[model samples]
Target: MNNSIDTKRIVLAALFTAASFALSFIQIPIFPAAPWLMYDPSGIVCLLAALAFGPKLGAAVAILSWLPRVFLDPFGAPMGMLSTCCLIIPTAIIYAKSGNTRAGSIAGMVFGAALSIVAACALNLVVTPLYTAVTMEQVAGMILPILLPFNTLKMVINVVAGQVLLAPCMNVLHSSKA
Candidate 1:
């Protein structure tokens, strides 16, 4: 096996991942949605990691971030487990290349939200058939009604919240020289 990730990268990713998990506990109920798809600045941290490092770091931060959440509160169902992996990596990658400037982060977030919508659509298709009690057609129909819109909402929420909020937070962290 060729295991070659740098130690500093892993440590950073672990820190980011831990931050991601910790952020979940500070929840604000968004409505009737269970587990209430949230606005986590942690995504900002994950995005920052990918921005500072690269996709490998992004994936590590993303996957590691979700593991504890799954054990703690697997939302919607088992199928939704993969949704975590699906949503954040694209967000991470988008943020990484664009972090060269503030405008770049905004542009990347717009693109990232669109990417998240696509990933969410695909996850619905792949997971719904296995988990839903209805026929595949019914599952598709029922889920499409909520899944697409909720995902779009999630992406947009992430993009807007991440850009407006996480950017400043990240800036403060980076500027502190800690």
Candidate 2:
């Protein structure tokens, strides 16, 4: 029985991780000011994985999902992976702690979104200067104007999409267990 459950978890994780990686390729540039800072729906899959399984699994999926991008964009990919984990882990943890209620999901999503934005901003301040020609001051300047809005939008999209699909996904998973 334990082995069966483990196998199911492994299969689910693999599927979610693959879905996230594939979704990462579909980037939508919402903010004109920072076209390079595109939003990918990969985080939604990570959020779903986290909410379904656990934070550790969610974080694992988040990191694995961005691994391909690491080869493609070494410096930028790490930032994306970090920011994604920031969003997934918190949401999973908070939701689990809050008894898995709808309110808990809301709280978790809001908290996770805020944290992801803040972490992305801080990472930009430190790492953006290293890869890009942008200085820390310039990055700081763009925080309020560009980074904040872009990250916020990204999180909002992820949260909304995750919420919409979550109940159905959960139902399917539960039924499968039976």
Candidate 3:
């Protein structure tokens, strides 16, 4: 493991980031329990990194996953890129550092889900009011209650999926350890 930034690592991470971005953009549109909610696989890509690599790599890859989204989307920085950082990086670190045991997987999921809920609420507090007038603010409040829970569910779903799939992924990762 090189301490400083290696070009190889950077390029590989860029590929990971691209995979994540592609996953997020590919909207398969699962039936979300909440209004205007959708499930995506990008978070799984980030978790895959955490399981295969270490915390620092996980964090960096997580950041890469969202940076392009922040730029390309219309509602760009309103949710605060920092909020995404808060949710994804720590979750990745927790999973990476724990060495991906069953207990650690659950703990990581709980941490990530809770963080996502908090960040959504906080960002909505600021971004919601700014994006719309008073009439829209009322709608925003109504929307938040519906949406937050669904986001939490997404975290839970991803964690469970990762836990089930980790062994297979690890096998593939291991074979390439040349």
Candidate 1, 68-144: lDDT as tens digits: 76666554323333444445555556565664567766766666666666666666566656645646666467455
**lDDT of model 1 at residue 42?**
53
Off by over 4 Å in 1: 1-11, 25-44, 69-99, 176-178
The sequence of per-residue lDDT tens digits that candidate 2 reaches over residues 1-178 is 2424487899999999999999999989998988988888999999999999989989999999899899998888899999999998989999999988889988999999999999999999999899888899999999999999999989989999989999999999888994
lDDT at residue 92 of model 2 (Cα atoms): 92
lDDT of 1 at 100: 55
* Worst lDDT 10-window in candidate 1: 75-84
Leading candidate by TM-score: 2
Poorest 10 consecutive residues by lDDT, candidate 3: 74-83
Residue 137: error of model 1 in Å?
A: 1.2
Better candidate number, 2 or 3, judged by lDDT: 2
> RMSD to the native, candidate 2?
1.7
Query: Could you report the Cα RMSD, in angstroms, for every candidate shown?
Result: 4.6, 1.7, 3.2
lDDT of 3 by residue, 1-178 (tens): 5578667567667777788778877655444554445676777777667556655676677676767777675353335244445555666667767776767666776686678667766666566666566344564675556656665666677777777877787787677556
Models 1 onward score TM values of 0.69, 0.95, 0.76
